[model samples]
Target: MIFEMTTQVRVSNIEEGHKWYETLINKHPDFIPHKGFVEWELIPGCWLQVAEGELTEGNGPLRLGVTDIEGERERLIKELTIERFEIHSRPEVPVKWGTFRDPWGNRIGFFEYLDKKEEETQIKSILGTDSSRV
Candidate 1:
């Protein structure tokens, strides 16, 4: 059996969006940097592409469930000058997740399955429970 998924994100400037994905791939370990596309090969024969857009409301691949949410978020803020961006909601998902628009008005979400140990620690800290129980 074979399975594949492709998603698209709209952008105003393909060059800028390409650069953003390039930086992300360079900074993150999971991504395999490609000239025209940034790919993440989660497993053999399965990959995700982040590439250039061909239209005014450009459509590039969608990225979801990314493990390095905080790092990616910081990089986007530092590198790209987003015209306007907003966090639609907090990380209420089992996996820490949130959405934001890029400089070109492309909507993207960053997320990952929460680390069990990290989640336990976070819950304990919030409830003022003892570390020993975590």
Candidate 2:
């Protein structure tokens, strides 16, 4: 069975890319196995790697689930100086999402479930705790 996954993005400079991703994710990488490569375990089985290499152009708008999309947008703008991006949703859709680009032009985005209960359940599942109690 396909049980785990990893996604990679490339940048010309490892130091700058590492710092940028660390700030965006609000934590240092969980793994740095060698020079010029770093990774974060975004969830239990999913990993995101940033490596030193040619830019991976037009790769993705890798969306992360968030509790507050607008708040995250504001934080990214203030902290990373990213250009403001619009959040969108539809009546038929269960979540709202927004996209922006990192300094190296990697597409990144965040999403928030409209149903707060569902979002909480997901959070608990990923973290193995009731976030509200923590």
Candidate 3:
């Protein structure tokens, strides 16, 4: 019965948090119900919430699946001025990934699947979009 979900990331200030996330996610949030809280419905029922509060240490490297992790990492650096982070991978792992922290220190990362066909299938299922779009 747990059909929907949300993951929250805390920041010290809502104003800065909102602006940063908008830039990182490349769009405005799906909803901002009140002050100090904003939410993005990343895909259908999955939500990522940014809220105002003391940032917790050792929180997360909430890895988002991408079709091109290197491309996305470079874009984040150029656009958001994110510090360059290295991409790491191994034969045992299915994807290569890179990690970085947000301005408020929330650990976030991007991952690209090794198997293109599998990545395409996931993109279609999760985003309900054409595989080419991934």
Rate residue 125 of model 2 by lDDT: 88
The Cα error of candidate 2 at residue 91, in Å, is: 0.7
Q: Candidate 1 lDDT, tens digit per residue, 1-66?
A: 555654444344556655675564554324536554555553334454555555335443244555
Q: How many residue pairs clash (N, CA or C atoms closer than 3 angstroms) in each of the candidate models, in the order given?
A: 0, 0, 0
User: Residue by residue across 12-117, what tens digits does model 3's lDDT show?
Assistant: 9899889988888888999999999999987789889999997898988887887788888888899889999999999999999999999888899999999998
TM-score of each: 0.50, 0.96, 0.94
Give the poorly placed runs of model 2, Cα more than 4 Å off.
none
Error of 3 at 52 (Å): 0.8
lDDT of all predictions, in order shown? 0.54, 0.93, 0.89
| Native-to-model Cα distance after best TM-score fit, residue 102 in candidate 1, in Å | 2.6
RMSD of each: 8.3, 1.0, 1.2
